[model samples]
Target: MSSHEKLSAAANDRKARLAQLKSLKRKQAPTSDEADAAPSPPAHQAEISDAIVRTEEEGEAPSVATTYLSGRNYDPTTRNVKLGFDNLPIADPTNTLEYKAQQLALETKAQQEAENKEDNGLDLFKLQPKKPNWDLKRDLEQKMKSLDVQTENAIAKLVRERVEAQKVIRQKKPADGEGEEVGMEGSELVEAMHLKEQEEARDRRRDEEDEDGIYRAKVRIGTAFTLALHEAISDRGPCDILESVNIRSNPSVRSKTRWKSVARAWI
Candidate 1:
């Protein structure tokens, strides 16, 4: 069909439906006399009907029961009223299980942090002290100084023992005179013994020189250079200091005298 015919048919259908609705309303609507003589509705129902009619005429949807009641005479305090802060339904939310759990977790985390801090402070592995470079240098210097002192003391002790041994050997020479006479019956044996004594004395002299040289070289450094040089040089003809001081006479007295001289030189 044509567009014009289709449109005209739709319009006719709409008008027919409207006419049917008007006839139905005419049949169903109450007559004027019936409306006037009919029993009046209850006051509350009349008010509801009037409200609904007003909303409909104003092109607005009917409000809910709560809205309608609120628009009229609504007093929320009547049913579930809030008297004061203490009368609230869920007053202390802090006492809830979820809140307690959250608080416990936070407290546990804080306690763990505190314990970790304390452990870090006290733990030997973690509590390493960080010394400065200067401190380390000072400690090293002190250790070196102590080691130097110990070495000097050890050398001095060895020298003292050697000197004591030599003294004992020298003292035993007198006691061997009787045996030496009996043993020296032959000239060849006497000459050999004499040569042996001379060689032993030379070896002792060479050992003494070597020992003094080593002591002087090893100890002569910094403040001890002057003292060691003075002690290594003899007063007689620039030879063994021990011989010049007559170490065999009174060694302790000579050592004390040497210290006094060093102190005087410093002063």
Candidate 2:
């Protein structure tokens, strides 16, 4: 394409890309609805407006048995009657005043009986302690005996220490054994035995240096540089070979050749 056409195509592509980005951003924005714009508090159940309990109507009216005669002039089938002074029944002279004497006598008897039975109950006394079993007593006795023994040992040690601290207290020298018993060995014999052992050890010094029985193999990192320098300068050869090694430098020499193994064990 020509330069002008390429530039125009590039500009068109850039504009198309910008338009697509703007459309994507618009799709990501939030809606304007009240429920969607901001968060709202959770809804709760409505409060109860009425009482839980209800009572029956108790107007100035009393109910009676329908089958019994009321003994006064009134309608037999009437349900509710308004209470008034004229409609109130005459109080019987016998029923109310007759029970007063018996009620007083009963009240006196009840008060006396209540006073006789008045007690705080058996909560004041402490309960008896439970008896210990045989095994528990035995274990307790054993522990006590052990404690006694430890205490006695401590006391005896303290007494002995105090006695030793007293300067006037003298220890008795032990009496010599029977007069004819043999005497102990002299120091010369110990010296002679020590010299013999030294001679034997000198004879086995080289074996002690080589053998694993008498010598401990050691590898220390701190002396690594010094050891390398020491080994390089010293005339010490490699480990003693279990087999042999041979090189093919002089091939024509019909000498018996051993394997040139690289398995050199280090000390």
Candidate 3:
């Protein structure tokens, strides 16, 4: 084979290996991002961990230093500090301790004076009493009672007027003649009259016939009367005699009476 062909084969092989590595890297990229974006710690745990880190970084020892003495070493155990005020020779021969004690005493006196000034500036006396005013509750109650009485009277008067007006209207409008007649006669009374007429007519025809037909007619009429009485009494209290009479007169219910009577007698 020629040198150019061998070099081409070698280049193809290298390219294939590079492509394989690239594919592998693509597959692992998502896992890398997932690892980097791990879930955050819980809030309470994070706070506690942060507190521990801060406490470790900042030593936990207390430093006994008073602001009154600058550039002075303070004993942590005794919580005492020596002032450097008199370290340099000056017009005063008093020791640093004595000067520090005088400064402390002056500061204490000033603080006490400030406290006294604050206390004296405050007014501790009770406030003066306000003038007595009218009782709103009692006033409102009296007004409500007055209004209730007035409203009740007005309502009563209005109702009375309306009732009188209705009475007048009723008096002026006469009842219909037909309705009045029907009301007076009643449905039951009319039905009873009709039934009685029918029975009388039947009896008259039966009398004209021989004995057997007359007895049958009498039996039929008796049966009809019994059925009507039963229907009226079936619902509640014994059928009102007046109501039964009216039902017998009623054109609608009256027609069924004959059939009901026959059924009753047969049974």
Candidate 4:
């Protein structure tokens, strides 16, 4: 349709709605006769309803609820403590046969549990001691001791055999002036040379041991004397201490002391 027809139709519809709303308002309004016959509300309630209608008409602010069906009536500083009822007996019917049977069953079950809790004989407090780091040394010491004893016994046995061999050689030795051509056999000569070599080797080892002992004694004495001199000269003049050391520590005196220390170590 054309724009002018659409506008006219919309205005006619708006007029029809306004007329219908006015008719409904007229029907809902109380008539003068009905207003006189109906019971009136209290004066205070009438005032409150009039105030609510005026608030709704004004455009200043929205209205809020002024009356409450349920309201708080406690003081701000007061605490609400709940009373305890733990001492009160249970609400179950205690005199009944079923209740008594249940109580007896509970008691018997508790007694059975108590009797079953007997001693198990396990001691939780008896702890084993921990093994230390030096336990390795402890275990090896016994084996080392056995080995050393075996070595010493073997050496002693070899020494005894050598002694017997040497005695036999000496007894069978030919006299220097005898004309008899009684000479040592090749095996005997070889044995004699081997024994001589062993003796030489043993002597060399002994000499080395003696030298080592003497050196050790010298080192120990020198260290001790140095420590003692250092302590003694702590409060003395350096020049005087040096002079006294130079005078007292002669080569001959040092040699004598070294020998004394070595003798003591040997003893």
Give me the runs in candidate 2 sitting further than 4 Å from their true place: 1-130, 133-135, 168-267
For each candidate in the order shown, give its overall lDDT on alpha carbons.
0.61, 0.47, 0.59, 0.59
> Model 3 — TM-score against the truth?
0.16
Q: What's the TM-score of each model vs. the native? A: 0.23, 0.14, 0.16, 0.20
The sequence of per-residue lDDT tens digits that candidate 3 reaches over residues 118-203 is 88754648556532222644676788898989977986796677567656655776765546544644664577679879987996
User: Could you give candidate 4's per-residue lDDT for residues 1-267 as a string of tens digits?
Assistant: 999999688667745744554464458778899999999889865654555444545743222222211113422233333345435465667987888999999999998888777534556697665433247557777788999899779867976786677567666875552232223334555786798799879977976776678779889988876655454545445544434444344566665444433333322
Clashing pairs in 1: none
Better of 3 and 4 by TM-score: 4
Worst 10 residues of 1 by lDDT: 233-242
- Indicate which candidate wins on lDDT: 1
* lDDT winner between candidates 1 and 3: 1
lDDT of 1: 0.61
Which candidate number has the best TM-score?
1
In Å, residue 108's CA in model 3 sits off its true spot by 99
- Which lDDT value does model 3 have at 120? 78
Identify the runs in model 4 with alpha carbons over 4 angstroms from their true place: 1-186, 234-267
